[model samples]
Target: MRKLGVKAAAAAVILASPAAAEMEYSFYIGSQSAPHSVLSGTIDGTAGTAIDSTVAWEGRSTAPPPYYGMRGVYWRESGWGYGLEFTHAKAYASDADRASLGFDSLEFTDGHNIITANIHRRWKNQWWNGRLTPFVTAGVGVAMPHVDIQHGGGAHTFGYQLTGPAARLGAGVSMAITDRMSAFTEYQFTYSDNKIDLDSGGTLETSLITNALNFGISYSF
Candidate 1:
């Protein structure tokens, strides 16, 4: 009976102790930018029978909005962690650029869905009574770019979906709200090597670089 009592008391003490490691889930919304403009093919012939070839275009072509994503992380008391994430964004062609492409309104949309595995290191210094933590992260992953091209008046449409490898570097700060929750903001730069083939006898090679800013809340358990 004494041994049983001692075991029960030891179990109670262990259960009351704090955990040395934790897992977190986070969701965030932010802006993504592809700041380079795309060019169209060159034009041949003259007058009404002129043919247009690829031309070097300029300016940003995507709509202004924030992209959202989610992440799952496993962190230890020793300041090292690893995570998995998924994110998405969209891009479109400008109307004037479409007219320059020899169509009434030739427009294209780019939809990207990416999955990544990341490793991070956190700094343990506290600015506001252990509420703040700073981190740096880097990772390599894969992306699927889904492209849709179409005419303005429902004349024709084409889809070119391709998958490729990608890499990213990022930094962020997290502020604690409670024992199990926190808020964070991060900035990341991503580069991808992607290529697409048009149905009309041409190919587009995209070695793209983009920047992103994100803010969100995280829950730890």
Candidate 2:
């Protein structure tokens, strides 16, 4: 009887471990917006003189390279979870800003991508027949942006580069459509500090704060 009790207790502990928890995968499309920021750096040929200019940015979320994200999470029975997420966000300098700043083209439209490790918490509620759950997440990550910049008769820098550090916070509610499927809408705020290399032979630095509204579906296993 003693041996049987010990074995039963061990089995219970095993079942309670996070290794037995649920894994969730989610995909989302979103619209993103950012505020004006100063782009400062040394352009190629002005004898290494640094210039500073305030740039107005446009989201253009629905344009050719749309905003999107994906995540994979592992949720414990205690409502705490951890995950990894990747978001493809974008920014473009406004035409007026381009003219004022004397740049032919400046954009990160192919994307300002962020990859993060996140911690999440959710509350179980007796709403919508117990299918509604509200959750929040916080993460830290890095920014890898495709730098596309051009100045009047200068080298065009166009490629992916590791720019800087990024962080994000989000809140959302998910409604279960089935035992293994859920639909969600979320609001996220992300901040990235970019120090990007210019092809003409210098570095451009800028900080971006972006707000996004996302709609998505998740599948759990």
The candidate scoring highest on TM-score is: 2
1-221: candidate 2 lDDT, tens digit per residue: 99999999999998778566899999999889978898888876446647698888888899988999999999988889999999999999999998877778889988889889999999866477788999999999999988888887688899999999999999999999988899999999989999988889878899987899999999999
TM-score of each: 0.71, 0.94
Report the Cα lDDT for candidate 1: 0.65
lDDT of each: 0.65, 0.89
On the 0 to 100 scale, the lDDT of residue 86 in model 2 is 95
| Model 1 per-residue lDDT at 76 | 82
Per-prediction count of colliding residue pairs?
Answer: 11, 0
> Model 2, stretches more than 4 Å misplaced?
15-20
Q: List the residue pairs that clash in candidate 2.
A: none
